[model samples]
Target: MQSPGIPRSREAAPAGWRETADAAIEGGDDPVPSMLTALLRRPATAFSMLAVAVLLGHAAAALLIAQLPRASFGVEAIEDGMIRVTGDDRRYAADAPVAFVGSDGRVRLARVMEDLVPELEPRGSSSEITAIYAERDRIAALLREPGLMLRLPDGRQLPAAVRPGRIETLSSGFWLSFGIALCSSLAGLWALVLRPREWAARMFMLSGLGLALGAITIGALEQVSLATGSRTLFWITHINYLSAYIFGFAIVALFARYPRPLIGKALLAGFAAAQGAIWVMGLLKLDVDMLGIQIFVVLLLALLAVVLAGVQGWLSRYDPALRASFLLIWISLLLSMGLFSIVSLIPQLMGSPDIVPESVSAAAFLLFYLALAVAIARYRLFDLGSWAVNVGLSALVLIAVLAVDLALVLITGGTWTVSLAFLTAAILWLPLRELVLRRAERRRDKRDLLLLRGASEVAFAPRPEQQTVLWSQLLDRQFSPLTIAPVTCDTAAIRADGRILAIPSPLGGTGLVLSYANQGRRLFNSEDRSVATALVALVAEMVDARAAYDRGARAERQRIARDLHDDVGARLMTTLHRGDLETVHADVREAMADMRLIIDGMSDQPRRLSDIVADLRHETVNRLVLARIHAHWPITAIFDDERLVDALQARVLLSVTRELVSNVIRHAGAGTVSIRCALTGNSLLLAVRDDGRGFDVDSDTILGNGLRNTRKRLEELGGSMAVQSGPGGSVIEIGLPLPSREQGMSDRSMAV
Candidate 1:
């Protein structure tokens, strides 16, 4: 059993095997690079391709229009095509209408009655000029309103039907219109694709229906301008215009109920019934040419309904997502419809002959469609409706007040004083508003103080002084200077360092355990919980001060122990072992006396070298007398810290001084010795010169006993010793780092 079983060799196993397996099992060690790679893999969308196609189509159309002949008239009608004029509450007509021949002598018609062609006259272009044609009934009816005159290529004002040359240019306008409409349609399609779900399925379907209606409207406006010959196309244009108006109203109603299924279904049913009624009227030939007023009324009702429903839903505690949807939908509905109504009505009211009513309406609707798309794709308006209302009301009030004040001053005839006063009042609104808001907030906060009284709670336990007990459990919460939480609970007795008290709370209640220390005293308070907080700060200060004190004390003790071991203790021990009673008695007494003095000085404040130089000199002289050697020591660089300089850093200086005096007595047999101390740069230099029987400087046989040990002690003091011995005498020089006493006393130290 004693013979150990052959020990298993640990080196037989492979190295780093566990580490390799760990690395293999771990995945996704580098996260940032992998995320960047995933982002780079995302694909582009279809809208990019559609944009390219629209741009190319525009470029081709522009090229085609540039090649068309300039100022080429495209419409000519005369004679039987009678022109009727209606203006200033009356209609005018020309009987026995005669066709006006052109410069090339072509006569198109002769009429029994001409409505307004007699009002036109030609200059410098001659023709037979007399012809007749019967008036077309429908053309006469539509041309009945000639409130405005037209200018021809020859700069002549004429009736609507009687033109000396071609009256319309379709080539350039058609090419331009094609480019604009194509690009607009492409953009609209892209918008339609962009997250249309939020607008209720019915809204998206209505948008589709609006697009078809818009195309028909464009065709109707084009037909009226071109004066095409087809009767069917003429009447069909009017019906399409009515459809466009009705569909526009339906789109608004559907968008108002966006994201709600039941509202959308109800709206769709209403829209269908309205459309059927309008179609029936059109079929019966009621001639409904303008439906803008009817559509406007419908939209106004829908907006009012949306606002009321939104307020009711908010009061009923609807989900946050649904509430936000309703808010943004209402905002878009109000703003877009309001802008469209105002802008579209402007052209009709101004009666601008060049501006197209349908085109302006379409542009406004385009912007609305884009806004709707954004609202559906992004749940954008957390506060959009409120923000709009607040901003709008503020602007309106400020403008009205300022306008009234300015107008009153102006009407009363003003100087700069009145103008300046109104301007200052308007400019001061922002800061005045801010001040008022802050005051109101402060008042509200004060009123609710009772409710907030128990809102903050503080936890209490032992502070950091007792590491054996955990820190105050409530201290886990951060401390704020202005607000405090006070918590109170009984804690378990302190444990050893790092030991935790797992105190459980009762039933559903929460409780805390704290770190504690007992030095025959209780450290916590029964009242204010801040006692623990103050205790923590006090303990921290004590810890730093105690650490510094212990460090200095340890260093001083080690120095004293080393001195006794190498000096007095060694000397006494040497004398006792020699079997000389007289020498042993004297040496032991000296050692005991020196030990007592050292013990007494240990509690005293440190002293400087200059203060203790006289004592050192007397002790050195007595020792030298015992050794039968003469000695002299003169301190030249006197300092205020005598004990620090002579007792601490002067250890090397004193040792060198003693060794030099002893060697002169033992080996050199010198009669006299001189020791001098001085400062050089950051160092302390000492010179020990002696007159004795000196030996060869370089001879190995001349090496003295204990010389190596003396030189080593000098070097340990961060100094070097040089010895020169010849036939005449020997000199020993020692240099040391400046003492700490010297450092503290320096004038530059005050700046630190």
Candidate 2:
């Protein structure tokens, strides 16, 4: 089962699963506590190890920087090419270029510019820094010398010697940069661990790796006072620019295909080639904008791509869960990418000071990674479709557009060219957003109608077994859970943070468990639970109504069958044994009369209890006389004689009394029989007393078929029959329930 906080795995193929897809009540374990996190390994070993390795990599970067000669010029670049040398121990000239004489007799003139410290100074530029690149090889070879002659602005020349830098010498800024980079890498690995096959996750991880590489390499160069090596400096600059372009490419590719696929892998490859070429041009120093304008433009496209992706994802509401997942992805991408571009790239483009440190700006990428991690953990987990869409994601995107446009104009002298791009969106995007929401609402209504139709199919299925089948089918079609297992839950519930859902039968039986909603593409939420609850309730009501109808029909048929065996069958059997022709003829007539009563009893019409009792008394007396035994029943002794009884109850009452008389004649051989009737509580009480030779009533006495049939008739009316026998006589007691009469009926009943 797909559980929350874990990636969903492939569903195990159940035997004959295609026949029904998912079967209810087949016991299946909940897959909440998952072990298959990544590449068949646990998080501790796979993803955590990546973080540990990045930790070690940070130490290695620090160690490499420590190996560079510590110049300690005591002159820090305060701003664009401006140096501030404080205190007498400072070695560099305050207002003039410092000259260095290497062991190879090369005395190079120093010309300081913002290009030399573009990364260190907030407003530094690399425009004038190109000269050092051509001479980097010779200077790198000379740094190996033991000492060099230094000319300071103070006109004092001293021999400069190198001391090996310690770990303590590394600035806090360097640590912060590596730390941010490490965090970004870990975030990507975390997402990849959860969903290794997802392109969105893979691209997000790729972006993190790019961000990490760029941050660390730029940090190492910015920290270095003297060159590390001829090749090393070249490699560091190349890695920095390459990482920037890679980060941009990954972000753009991620936006193009995530939340919904706008482009395929082939187009993604094209994006890679384009971005890679831009990085190549930057490395070759082909133009003035190579390092700054071209790369920053790519970043701008990446941001625009994500915004457009988010817009497209929101508008295409076909997959509710996917749209929901895209909500987080879009908002986070907008805020993180938007903020970083504004504070870092725009300033560099506009020749303005950085608003925040580069490392801190890089920390904004962490939010992007965090959003991806959260989107991975949460998406493929369905939330309420419209709720996910309407949670201000579109507004945030629109706001980001305006904010970026405004920031660009405000930072870069407020140009109309930049402002024009966002002008149309700022005006029309909100209405377009509302239109999409309206479409989503219409779809939701249609979804509800479909559920109603499905419920009818489930509730009115001709057979109980078929009803169950249809029920399972209905749920499977609605939610499309990968696994629907058996659960002992009685009420509708969502478990494992919407990973598993329990849907109870309205008839109050064990329910089915649904895991990994949308075929494990999403988790279950309250919206799902509410949908399940509402649908099941409709099905349960119809099911209960149909069941009650079938139960009544079945019970009536059984009642008719029982009455036939006890009344008509018993009378005809008794007459066949009788040798006298007149007695046989009289018995056959009585049987026909009883059959008419049974037929009349099928109607819902009520009869007077007083008249039913009088007829019953007369029939019992005649039977006793026919058997040559005295019978007694007082006409007025029956109390509550005005009460009415339904036709079924009246029919049961007469047939049961007659069966008692038959048992006495055929088995008791009684001389005197007396009948009594009354109402007690909600029941009608009847007793037959016979004065005869007593028979065993308590010692496992077996009743004749006639007597057994009498008890069965009583049971059909929800009544009971009990026998008490002693030396004097045998007494048979019967109690049949008196259902409440229909409201507003007159309290009048006619006697016979």
- Which one wins on lDDT? 2
Total backbone collisions, model 2: 7
Which residue segments of model 1 deviate by more than 4 Å?
1-44, 49-101, 104-253, 263-270, 273-318, 346-369, 379-752
lDDT of 1 at 112: 28
- Per-residue accuracy of model 2 over 64-165 as CA lDDT, tens digit each: 876655543444555333554434434332346566666675775464422223233211134443555545444444445666765565656555545567
Shift of residue 2 alpha carbon in model 2, Å: 18
TM-score of each: 0.37, 0.49
Instruction: Please provide the root mean square deviation of candidate 2 (C-alpha atoms, Å).
Output: 13.9
User: Per-residue lDDT of 14-90 in model 1, one digit per residue for the tens?
Assistant: 12333333444456648764554343222123345545775675555345323322211123223234333223222
Query: Which predicted model would earn the best TM-score?
Result: 2
lDDT of candidate 2 at residue 395, scale 0 to 100: 42
